[model samples]
Structure formats: C-alpha cells, structure tokens
Target: MKLFTCTHCGQLLYFENSQCEKCHYPLGFEPKQLQLFPLVAEADGRTYRLFGTTQPNAPTYTYCRNHADGVCNWLVPAESATQFCTACALNRTIPNLSEPEHRLRWWKLEIAKHRLVYSLLRMGLPVVSKFEDPEHGLQFDFLADASQDGGQKVMTGHDNGLITINIAEADDIEREMARKSMAEVYRTLLGHFRHEVGHYYWDQLIDNTPHLTEFRALFGDEQDDYGQALQRHYDQGAPNDWSQHFISSYASSHPWEDWAETWAHYLHILDTLQTAHAFGLSVNPAAAPAELGLQAAITEEPYEISDFNRIMQLWLPLTFTMNSLNRSMGQPDPYPFIIMPEVVDKMAFIHKVCQQAGSSAKAAC
Candidate 1:
C-alpha cells in the first residue's frame, strides 16, 4: 500500500503499474526489494535485467506467467525456474477468460490479491502455494455463479486453505447490491480477499499454537457448531449490542467469523497506517484540547511497531480525519467500522501473533 517510484524516470508509480508512463520503461515488481524497477530484456530475450543495480552479475528476472493475461505485474527471478511469482502460483482456478467481461473481472480480482499478498509478505508470514504443499498450502478460486452454468452458486468463503470468491462481486452494481442486502456499511474486493485469507492464516499460524487459548477466550470458542451458529445468526440476526463486541454484524455469526473479521480489520489498519507513514501523514487539530490526545504522528512502519496501543492511537485519529474528508467530498466514509474496546483486544492478539511469526521467521533464517 506504500507509494512506489519508477527507478528510471522517478515517476510516481502505483503498485499495479506495469510500465512507467513518463519514461515508457517496462516495470516489474521485485518482491524481495519491495520495489518497482525498470526492466531491460536480456540477450536471450526470455529474462530482464533490472535497472539501478550496479552488481556485475545481478540476477535476471521475468514476470509471472499471469502477466501475459495482464493480471499480474510481479517478477520471479529467472534462475528460480518458477513460471509464476509467489502470488500468482496460489491460483487453484481462474474465471474462464473466453468471455470478455470475465477477463476484466479477473484483472480486478488480481489487483486485490496482489495487495493482500504484499501485506502478508511484508509481515513475514508464510505464503506457500497449494502446489508447494497440497495438503495445507493456500489456494484461490475465482468462480462464477450458478447462472453462468446451471450449477451451485459460488460463495465467497474459505474452507481449509482454499478461498473461493464469487467473480460477480467484481462488478460494482453486484457488490453494492450484496452489501445493501447484507446491511453492511463497507464492503469491497480487497475486504473479501483480506477476510478469507484471514481464515487461511488461522490454520497456518494459530490453529494448534499456544495462542489458541487466548484466541478462544477473546473471540469466543470456535469449537461451537459453525453451521448452526450461522443458521441462528440468519434466523434471528445479530445481538442488539453487537457493535460493542464485534467488528461487524456478520462477525457475530460465529467465533471463527469473529476472528476472521478482526483479523481482516487488523490487516486494514496495518496497511492503511503503512500508507500513512509512507506519505508522512500526521493528524493534529489545533482547536482540540490536549486532554483528548487527538494528535498522532506516524513515525514508523505499522508492521515494525510492536505496541498495539500506538497503532490504535494513530489509527483512530487518522480514520476520523479520513471520514470527515469523505463527508466534505459528498462520498461515503472509506472506513465505516468502529474499533471498540473488545475489538481492540482481539486486534492486539492478532498483532502479537503476527509479530511472533515474524520473529520466528527471522530466527530460522
């Protein structure tokens, strides 16, 4: 979510940009470096040399095979012998591209997926693809509804490590209708990706770990029957005080959902805070009293900040300003959920787990 620049022309580039507009330089994202660099084709024409590297034997790279479909801009070191980058390799199924509209929907899905993958990698979390570990590795399927083929409707949910998304959600009208029908304040393609992947990481990071005890205590016992819990949820709706305990009404449906919803919000906070930090954003209202503590300065990356209190401190004021700005522009608030005390407790647990995961990865190195 941080801003990026083209190495060749210093043009401010976006995460999804495949070329620098100013210099017309071909661009590819270097995940290891977390950079977008200009690419030059090598002598054999199958690999590219990255610009701005002085090493005499710098590794040549190639874009993920999905790049050919215009859905990926990430690079893979040519020597690694993998056709897809870490992110693209997780695909279990892609919407049939024979339909022109499906191609555009797939492109929209990839944008969200890449951003999700970038955050996971930035946090040093494991991102093994299903191909690498068939039993437990993560996979994704972008599928169409029953209307497309007289079959079952594709529900956007996660089972085991596979996340299935309804491709129609990429359409603005379809997604908006679903949001209203569900009585949700905020929903988007990125939110769906974040929420489902949260389920995947629960298996990878916390399922049998020591954190499970605290997780159960905070998020409720996930051991409860999921199907019945959801049935009850839909039958009677959320509790009147749901906002006091859960991030969203849907989160109140079951313990697992509560955890996933909180996890997704935790990610939203980290990525948004990181973007704020990248832009050197700070919030201070001259008219506010000092006792309100309504000031914050984002001095460090959110992932590196171990103090959850510090993150929440900055995030609250940032969201307030952001919402106010949106109101001024006659647009809905970009962030519509509130982070109450109980939600904060769950988010802190997530922050601790992610920090521990990052530390464990470093120690193994």
Candidate 2:
C-alpha cells in the first residue's frame, strides 16, 4: 500500500489513520475522491465538511453516524444517496446488530474490507459499485447465514461480480472447521478477499479482453459447462492429476477454478514479497535472477514471478521455512498452497498482463 499523509501537516500516516498525529486534524476517507480529508464540522447537527488538499476541490464528506456511537469509522460522499460509504455500501445483509457480538464482528469485517479495497484501488483496476451497475458492476455482499444454529445456508461463493461472504466465516471456530474440512493449510479473511477478487477480475479481464484464445489455451474453454464441472467435482472428486498441475486439489474441479486459484496465489505471493521488502528483509523480488540464485544459496527468500524460474526455487525453500516457523508456534503453515512450476508460469503471465494493461491505460489517458 502507498503511504498516506495527514493533509493538514503532511505527516506520514497509514491508510487506516483516522486522526493526524501531528496536527490533530480529524481524518476521514472521501471515497469519491479516493482521499482522506481533514474534516471540519459545521456549527450544526451531525454533518461535517471535508477539506484536505492533497486533493483540492475534493468531494464533500458525510460521516457514518455509526461513528458517533463509536461503531464505524467509514465515511460516505456527501453527494451520494447511499448510507454506507464506498466500502460499507457493499453489504447485502449483515448479522443482527442487536447482538453485541455481531456488532464486534461487523467492525472487524469492515476493517478487512477497507484494506482489501485499498489494495485493489492501488492496483489501478476498476472497482465500480455493483449497485451502480446492476448489470456488471463489481460489488460485495457480506451476509450472515444463521450463526445461531437454526438456519441452513451453508456456502460462500461468487456469482458474477457479487461476492457472498457467509458471516460464519467471521466466526473463528466455524472458519477453522471449514478450513479443515476442505483440507486447507492456511485460511484467513484477507485470503477470502484475494480469492473473491480473482472471480471478479476473471469477469472483468477475460470476459472483456481479446485474450479468449490464450485464456482457453492456458485455462481451458470458458464456455465449458460450469455446473457440470462442479457437480462432477462433488461426486467424483478432483482429478488425481490435480497435484501435478493445479495449485489446489479443488482447482482441478474446472479450468475456471484453476484460474481463480492461481490468481489468488499471485496476489498472495506479491503481497507477501512486499511485506518482506517493507520490513527490510534481504529478499528482493525485483532483483536480477543471478543475484537471487546467490541469495538462494544461503537463505531461501520469498521470490517473485517477475524473477522467472529463480523465483520458484527460492519460494519453495522460503515457504518451507515459513511453514516450519508457524509450526514452531503450534500454528498452521503460513502458505498452505504449493507453488508448482506451472502455477509459477501463470503468475508471471498475470504480472505481465497487469503491467501491460496499466501502461495501456495510462497511454490512452
């Protein structure tokens, strides 16, 4: 994520900052402007005006009244009719806020959602509201399906651009059980965001771009019978050859499943490498391959798809060490999925596609 600032004092701040440490300016994100503004309240009820010029003439802002009650920190655009801000507006149905525990989970969900959006926006990808584009806009639907033991709703999957997050995934025990049932080594809320985004981008890129032939060649025919593939997966299980080719066992369910799983891993590796760099680790995914090989000689460091085969070599050892460290703490491995050579190539392909798309967009602008 890019470093943000307190608009008033130019003090470095994080994306999650709601107050300026240097100038005491109350901060709020203006989603329409994609900025965090210095908020000043008018001498009236609960309304507040926005002024921050890191973007001059930024859109005016309205605080989520939940902020007054200390339940939410999200901000909505003053001109928008939506009650939730750009982040919270995606909710289809949240848990019963009447229950104190549900409210607590809601805050945690909101925080993770904001972080996920921030990363996506930083990538310069389009994030249109599903509400705005009922036909094709990207949106999320976070809902709770009877955590109280009477309801029977039991899945969280994607349908087109909408992401349905079973709120039970928010519960620690429930998520862990699902993770175990699915034989997953690692799972988290952030991972869900990355995976769901894979489905969204598949809709945005493959469905919109001229890469149909290449997509089919690499992933398989998109026109394949999806329902049949899923049903076959449930009945017969993933192909035994899944381990040699697909990133996960479930990925063998269908070519589209493979694409989404690979896409999620690409994000995971990139973000993990970024975290390594930010923390002053010696690993450099951007470095030359020969240098990486030399580093790999001493310590297995996280690698980048951009670095070619050298990356996979380094990644395996590094992730192995990472998993061992987690095991030492009596926790599951940090990266549950394997990085096969085929998956590495796909990750490289995605990195290149993103780079080309970004450059193409900028040149057109």
Candidate 3:
C-alpha cells in the first residue's frame, strides 16, 4: 500500500480514510488512478466529482452499496451498473447485520479484504467476482461457527474458488488464542485472506499450465491426498529441517499448502516493500558493518520489479528495521520468518507466475 494525500488540503491520508481530518473533505478511491481523491458533490446530489477538476463532464462516482453498512468505502463509477465495487462484489455472504456485534466484525474483515484486493489489482492479477464468472470466479463467505449459532463450524480455507472465513477469527481474543494454540509466530485477518486467496490463484494461474512442472519440482507434487497429509502433519509435526525449504510448519502439511504459504509471503513482501518505497524509507545504520548486509533501499515498486532477488534485497533490510521498531515498543516481530535459499527459489517461481499473468492480461487487452 502506498501513502496517499488529500487533494483538497494536501494532508497525509491513509488507505482506508473516508475523509481528510485537516480539511474535512470527503474522500473516495479512484481505482483506475490508484488515488484517494477529495470528492465534491455533484448538483443532482447523487454523484461526486474530483476536488481539483471543474470540467462539465468530469467522471462521476459513487460509493459502493456496502458503504451504507459502514463496512466498505470503495467507489464505483456512477455509470457502472453494479452496486458494489470490484472488491465488495467478491463477497458471497456477509455476517447477519441485525446482530450488532456482527456489524463490527464485518467491518474489520472488510478492511483486511480491501487491502488484499488492492494488492491484487496493483499486481494486475485477475479479480473476477463469482457474479461475473459463477463457475470459477473468486468469492468469500464470512460465517459464524457452532458457538455463535448452533451451526457447523466454519473453517478458513478455499474450495474451488470460494473462501470461507469464520467470523470468530475477527475477535482479537479468539484469534490470539488460536495463534498460541497453533504455536504460530504471526497471524492476522489480512494474513488469512492472503493465504486463502493464494489457493484460488494457484488454480487459475498454475493448475494446467507449463508452470505446474516447475511448481512441482520446487514445492512438490500437490496431487497427494490433502486430508491424510494434514493428519500426519498434526500427529507427527514438521521435521527439524523444515525451515530449510518450507516457509511455515503448516506449509509442510501438503504441497498445495506450501504453495499457498509461499504465495502469501510473496504478497507480504511486495506490499510491505511498496509501502516502504512510497514513504522513501531506507534502512542504513551507520554502526552496522557492511559485511552484515543489513543496509538497503527501495527505489521501485515491488510489483513491477521482475527480478525476485532485488525484491529480497530490499525486504531483508526493511524487515530488520521493522522488527527493531517492534522490539522498542515491547511487541513481537512484525515479520517473524526467515527466507532461506530454497524458499527464495519458490518465491522466484511465484514472481514469474505473477509477471506472466500480468503480461498475458496486457496482451489480451
């Protein structure tokens, strides 16, 4: 995510901000421009025009219908027939809003989902909603478990193209307990979205392509029985040398999981690196020796960078700086995993997959 500014007041703004605090200007994101524009209401009171523009035919826009529920702030062209923005359109089921607590949880989940969508759009990846392509499009369901509603437990996983997330995970206490129980170093709503969506993309981008051969060589064959693989993983646990190739213990459960885990880490790296680049952040401590190789800088967007090595070069130093800041505040490391040589090879494959997808989209255009 990149830093944004209010066009009306030049005040620094965040990705999710709906109004500029300094100027009280209404704001809406322009997806085509990738900008958070200060909005001016149109004469009919149904559309908005950009703050600095005065053209009679300036593009008009309106907030997605989800905005009325306070769960989404994304905008759509006024001329668009769809009521939801690209991101909100992916939602197959939302928590029942009649329950007061469910509203807040839905809002939290939307924040994370929007961020995930933003990154996907930035990478020029396919993001068709289930409504657009019912058979293969991506979709989401925010569901409640048996504890909340005498229903079957909702597991956070992807099947075909639909991803189901238990609304309980949105509760901070519940999420923290699960994190500790699994002995995981890091976990969050955004991480869950990223990881599960990775499964969806694997089906779309690599399943029947030539890339599958390379994917299997690096991540292993995904044809193995998933349920049995997970059973063995929980019963015996990952081997001591798991980190030599896998990104997480859970990743070792199956080849599909390893790909999903690596894919999520790839998104984490690209998004964080882009944020650092937008802010012109550099990690160069004078006291740190050159041989330590902890000094680095980012001058380009990670999504556009074809070289995976360059992305890692900036990522390592950026993580070092981020972890140090977390420690200063007596918090756990923001990024708790190390990228080994074997893992980098897998990440490179993912990088190529994304680059190829982007190129194919452009060529079709």
lDDT, model 3, position 21:
95
lDDT of 1 by residue, 87-163 (tens): 99999899999988999999999999999999998999888998989888999999998654578888899998999
Over 4 Å off in model 3, which ranges?
Answer: 148-151
Candidate 2, position 329, lDDT: 97
The order of the candidates by lDDT, greatest first, is 1, 3, 2
**lDDT by residue (tens digit), candidate 2, 1-365:** 43467766888876667778888878887654556767776556455677532454544567865566454566876676777766666656666778777776776676777877765654556667777887777676667766577876846778878887776677788789988997776678777877887888887777768865677777778687999988998899877877778788877888788888888777676555544544444533344475444244323233223354655555554576677679999987788776666777677666666656556665776
TM for every model, in the order presented, reads: 0.97, 0.78, 0.97
In Å, residue 104's CA in model 1 sits off its true spot by: 0.8
- What clash pairs does model 3 have? none
Query: How far in Å is the alpha carbon of 133 misplaced in model 2?
Result: 1.0
RMSD (CA, Å), each prediction: 1.3, 5.0, 1.2
The superposed Cα distance between candidate 1 and the true structure at residue 103, in angstroms, equals 0.7
Overall lDDT per candidate, in order of appearance: 0.91, 0.68, 0.91
